[model samples]
Target: MMSSCAHPLHGKSVETQHKTAATTSQQEKALADIAAETQTTQPAPVAQNPLLDGLPASDIAGVQADAKRIYSNHWGPVSERSRYVRARILPILKDMGAPRQLEVVPVAESGYNPYAFSPVGATGLWQVMPGTARMLGMNAAKGYDPRRHVEESTRGGVQYLQEMYAMFGNWPTAFAAYHRGPGNMTRRLAQHPWKPQDGLDTMPVPPVTMTYVRGILGLSALVQRGLWTFPEPWETHQVSIEGPIDVNQLAEAAQIDPEELYRFNPGLNHSQYLDSQIVLHVPESMLQPLLANAGQAAPEYVHAKVRKGDNLSVIARRYHTSVHDLKRINPDLSTLLQPGQTLLVPAGHMDSTSPPLNPLLAQGRRIHYRVRNGDNLWNIAKRFGTTPAAIARANSIKSDKTLHPGDRLWLLARARTS
Candidate 1:
């Protein structure tokens, strides 16, 4: 019965074939101390996978055809991040009993920009932006990059999809809400603007957003029937982490490269996962030591367990440190820590005051921009297609209006691009 319950998607979707022992619930949540593990028997989410999960085969067939057309039209450059997203989501879909056809949604959604932002500002490989990331408790700094952590992002994305499903009671409606947000979808529905409240019928939405929801269903169907192939082949894995640590640290501990970690955990960014809890991903045998260490404490780094009412200043003071020092070592410190959480304190480093590193430094280039006489920060920024604050940050200019002609400014587009 347990195996049958787990194989609920058999004969229905390709996602069933993707599930493996690595992503079983027993391993995915194995990060906590032994005592915190639970043995509750919960049904897999296949029945409630999405609104479209219950659609008639005929309807799904139609969606599959439409999705292929749309995806083919908008295909763009394949980004490493997109590849990473595929790697993370495929395993999750299988684990949760989602159909394999679901893979098409990412392919269509990948065209806009590597950092596609909806009007609501969801961002990254999965389009999860800062605001939504915060809502999901993802830290953007301290090198904890959840946006770069594929598993965390996939989990968050799935959770978000599930919430939308609950609200509209259908896959199509939920997809629209996911893009436009429930607030806007509700407003559109109240006005009776486009189609009906029924997502399948399509009452009204921006044409692009409407197409987006349909594409997700359609492409998902195509992938299901094997009518389309994911442009890239992504092998799947199930990984488990054991301790509170940053993604970089986990990469080190796992004996896997940081890029590999980024491939598996797209939700992490330097800030969002400074001292993140244990995360799971595709298991790599080489990372066994790191995986084991991730569940335990490490030396050469201070692991501060957050207590109630502990803010940055309090935490710093308790450790005979300064908030500036704390922020310095934890570059994304601003984003990662919460009360009752744990943080990784680097040895002997405190003070969050280091100048932001040139984002291009990681890629081995020093980006420079020349100041124009008529250019204020905003104008200079607009000319370069960046934010004024970014220009200011690059040049270390205190006054937005202050700039001297011929001053060379570092253009940090690489960071923004990432």
Candidate 2:
């Protein structure tokens, strides 16, 4: 224990320490070299635009591809359509607190054409389906498909999108639901839970949905980045009209080309006559003239004298109107019918089986009336302010039995013209 001389074991221990230190240094240097090589070979992360909101950076490639496609292949027509509708649509989105970029939806769905109808019955600028349109308070019935109305359909589509967003909690998922349907998407999402980090690429949706999502995102991105710009919008104003008016007459009154008027009011293209009261869109410049013409138009309601055995239902059926509408017009009306008591009734047309209430009450300027379903001489004369005998005489009609739909008849002008 007290030996002064270095033992042989001590020298071996020092030599072993030195050899261990040298091996550790060599391993550290090799690790550093490997780290440098790896850094040099790896690609940099892609820079994402903040406006993409819920999309992940991994979607960049697909989004860019779609954006490029739109620019190259769809720019001209898409831009034109976008320019036309942005004025009408953007305000709605703004009022609803929705994203402004939603304007691109019409561009993708219908190229902003109000008349665009899908083979599956999706219609209007937003391409809403008939069932969906009906649920949104649009009249998608046989004679009037309001889904072809630009403002109505856009509101319906945006409301649907908003509902989807509420359900999914994000735009991408909401968009997927919009395409695939809420029920189907809910089922799919139940099977494969959505992960925001992984984005849509990893979602269990069809390729078409994926493409649709990417295209919408791409278009929105382009707008956000100023790579795409909507041109100045055409100015328009709305005029509320009591209708069943001729398109040509309306166009003439507004001093606008009939085709241009049709372009502004494409939803009425199903028939030449606008069959009900509607807020009609027109060029701003034509608004004043249209207003003036509307002022001079015939009254939509006419006075009727309650007669023996006459009831609200009977009168409503006689005029092709409803008791509800009759009550709405005559607020003080009671259930009891008092002969010689007056009530305001809608000056609506009567069908073949129903006789005119008071044919003599018609008093206004003459108009060209196209015979519609269930039209008879008495009802036609009552509608156009002429007597049944006068109509028969002018048109050379032998009897009311000879009248048919699509028959053109000229009614004699009323004694007191407007």
Candidate 3:
């Protein structure tokens, strides 16, 4: 059930109030459930030095205190869920060579929302967008949603941020580029260069990106001071798949929910997994068969010569498949195809046991809203005729009081019974 204050914005913006009126929006109700869970549960205290059992006493105590504080602060409102996501991402942070302190701040910056996006189109919990994600080999598709995969997304975020640092020669510039694409910052820095004394203050950036840096800094300070709490460490296992596979198919093969798969392997594209090896994360219970099947041969495709006016979408439609499937089966097909060039198209029911196809249509509809400057949760919620809590609930948001410009919030209908 929604909170008693759920219907607070009865007269808000009609255009944005589809959560109550649209029928096909299942994500809205799911987010509502998340909000309810956030309001009711109190998370257990996370161990501060997961790695401290063998450490010196002095180090153990300091690590423990830092862990506790970061855990607490990280769980501003939705402690349990926030902690869950933080725990999932902890290993990734460690793998990225992030200090314990740096790990906690990202949880704060993202509030555990894996799909967070910046105004300049950066996406994921780490806010990596399509272009950057592609460069890092993180594919975004229906069954293989890379944005939801903590390990891939976090690793890509680290790499992207490091690249930004190399470009601007400073953490602040790197972070600013994270919020407002590196291209924008590079242009600005070239036109209005800064002195050592000016620091980040002299850089020409949007107020929201500026505040994003501050937010990261604030989170880093709090976490460093041992002011937040973290979630319990959930065991992570690897699932390997071979050949042309789709994430949803792999999820079914493992007998786990697709959402769970996405949560762990957010770097996957939705439509299909190309004919290459991929290691996905899953609970320990579902790891065996996935690994065993990793050695199986990928489905072979027939070489079909391309004709004029042949696009992935059209070709996929002709073959009763999706553009994603086409892309996966034919990774060599560039955007511009030659008239006589051959492309590998999946033929027949080779993988009949796999999940139902048409993932493109299945995951088709989405609402994307651009974040405006000086916008807050209250204004956004009011604009949507939804409470701040509802908006927060929908987006895995912890605090219903803060926001950043260039941020994108996905809205769906909660009460539209279709």
**TM per model?**
0.49, 0.56, 0.46
- Candidate 1 TM-score versus the reference: 0.49
What's the best-to-worst order under lDDT?
2, 3, 1
lDDT scores in order:
0.49, 0.58, 0.49
lDDT of 3 at 207: 67
State the lDDT of candidate 2 residue by residue for 173-213, as single tens digits. Answer: 77777777888889998999885445567877887777777
Q: How accurate is candidate 1 locally (lDDT)?
A: 0.49
Which model scores highest in TM-score?
Answer: 2
Q: Per-residue alpha-carbon lDDT of model 3 for 123-192, expressed as tens digits?
A: 4466544546666766433344454466656666666665665577555566677666777888888898
| Cα lDDT over the full model 2 | 0.58
The per-candidate count of clashes, in order, stands at 61, 0, 31
Better of 1 and 3 by TM-score: 1
lDDT of 3 at 226: 39
